[model samples]
Target: MSTAEAVPKMHKACVYDQPGTCSIAIRDVPTPKPGPNEVLIKLTHSGICHSDYAIMMNTWRQLPVPTQTGQIGGHEGLGHIVKLGEGSEKLGVKIGDRVGVKWVASACLACPPCTESLEGYCFNQKVSGYYTPGTFQEYVIGPANYVTPVPESLSGEVGAPMLCAGLTTWYVSKPTVPVLGAGLGRMIYRLPELTVTAVCELLIQNMINIICVILEYSALLKCGASPGQWVVISGAGGGLGTTAVSLAARGMGYRVIGIDMPGKKQDVLDSGAEHFIDVTQFDDATIGKEVKRLTGLGAKAVIVCANSNKAYGQAVSMLRFGGSLVCVGMPEGEQVSIANAYPSSMIMAGHNIVVSAVGNRREAIDVMEMAARGVVKFPVRTVSMSELQSVFEEMSQAKVTGRVVIDFSAA
Candidate 1:
């Protein structure tokens, strides 16, 4: 059957009434018609991400624009292309094709970042669910050139998480892993003078210097971490955390230690981590000691996927001298202030830090291909479309076990 003929009107979606809360409200919104250079997606499943919580709370400053009241709140969606608007053919999009819709809904190619193929950092970008509307609806619109094609071999539920969480995590951590050994030969390796425990002790007093300037800025700049190095992923039980584990271990071939709660140890290991650590069982000395014990050195890179301010501060404590730490998640209203001595401390420590925003089409395509080939697996729990309100409550309570995907077809 023609893909358009297969799409039905009045599909189901979850809408949020206000920030910090969400519920399922049925609305008679029209099925969006694709525009030139656009494609209409008949969505099957959409995974709720941690950032969705921020959207629900109306706290994120980087949203394409402030979300309107009763806005739809999902970006990681999987669907089939039902119709291609005029000019979409040139982009190679076709009917009946499975595709993944991610956080970045649109970016102006003329911008310096976009021209350089760094669309994730584009100053002028629109986000799904924030600016141009989102994929929570049964039928949504997407850019033909921007969407990642999903393999038929992958399930819709699995494909859903790869769109945003998988792609973002992969993109953020990819630069740290070595590829054919081309990059790091020019870089110098230096160990930090202060240990993680020392950093922890000074954390309360030197909060601004250690977390913001030294750990956040220097790690991404001076460390020059490469592939084949050890990486530690914090908060490994959650959606983005799982993606970091799989991408670092399987995709990039880095030795990864996934750290989370004790109950998540097995899940972390299943995500291709070489080792796992339950944070509750460990003291400040545990992570660095274990990391050094396992690799004869501390982590070459640390990816912070936890939303707590403490996680962000402690991530640097796990790094080796000259290693890098990447910060991805943060809690609302919690300040991340690095102390004034960061430049000198980082110079003495010889490490770097980077704060990356999550929106990269090239890296998204790379990771999605990994998902399509079954190289990376994402575990998800499905809920009927009607249960979105309860799901939000569960999320607020930290009761969610894994990625939660809403099955729109249940409508």
Candidate 2:
């Protein structure tokens, strides 16, 4: 093996050092060396995400293991290999190869979950930015076999979100489950069949597409919400909310009432909702009454996408008699008190909650296929790395619409 030149001792990284209580501070920390079958990467771009919020704020409940101080925090990194450790050459990778790291850094493939083709549920998974250091730094290490290989034609900015936020449009993710990521950099992307333009358009529009299956399959055909019935979506401006809006209207032929703060009205309407509910415009109690007034004694179904206990409570009130309340988005806590939080009479009156999370491989294939066929449309926004703090604030306020991507070169 040819020996590489001398490496740097330290590199610039964003450290989670309680810099004002769970705030971030950029520091020069010791650089990491690639060990056996590992590759050292020089990152070109990284995406900012909402899950980054859960990690930085520690809002999620205690885990069997929690992230430590001085750990770098970023998962959607686009970079190239700068150095390789022992045995890395045998993995079909080499120095200067472009790769991406996703939410899962490494998994113990010998575990039952991995063996069963459920690497996502691997008990011994080492998540980037969590268990191991992540790609928030300029240089990060990735396992040779796990890193995703990017097509040479793909740009770092476009490839960055493809590693994550791209596949995530349909799922209602729990903030802590590496819905963001656990590792530095590796990608499984090799779809040369898809052009960069086609992917961008598809990802954006496909974000505008699910939930018909859960509603129809679980609630009995037409028992939940069928064609010509009203289905309300809370948090309709955000990612999953918008997709629910689109699918409920166009895919299932339901009349969609999208409920969000005032700023999201246009995007919600564009997603194919028949109506928009400005939650901020009315008192919390009055909001339910307005929904009833518009949809005639409440909506036939309600999908909760806002990640809050109160949002779930509000969704319960928005449901009509014998209606279904679909719970999609999960808050920071492991379990939220809902269905039972209501009175027994309410439960007996026939209100039910249905939970749906990540989309499976089939779902992914279906969505992408539809997107490639030009069947969906959605808008995407790009943000500079320097604007990450504001991005979190926008998310916290629910002011942003559609999808957002992080451009690491801006860092």
What is the alpha-carbon lDDT of model 1 when measured against the actual structure?
0.72
Q: After superposition, how far is residue 380 of candidate 2 from its true place, in Å?
A: 4.2
Q: Model 2 shows how many backbone clashes?
A: 14
Tell me the number of clashing residue pairs for each predicted model. Answer: 19, 14
Report model 1's TM-score to 2 decimal places: 0.82
CA RMSD (A), model 1: 10.5
- Per-model TM-score, in order, reads 0.82, 0.65
Using lDDT, give the best candidate's number.
Answer: 1
Per-residue C-alpha lDDT of model 2 across residues 108-136, encoded as one tens digit per residue: 76888767545556788877777578777
Q: After superposition, how far is residue 320 of candidate 1 from its true place, in Å?
A: 0.5
lDDT of each: 0.72, 0.65
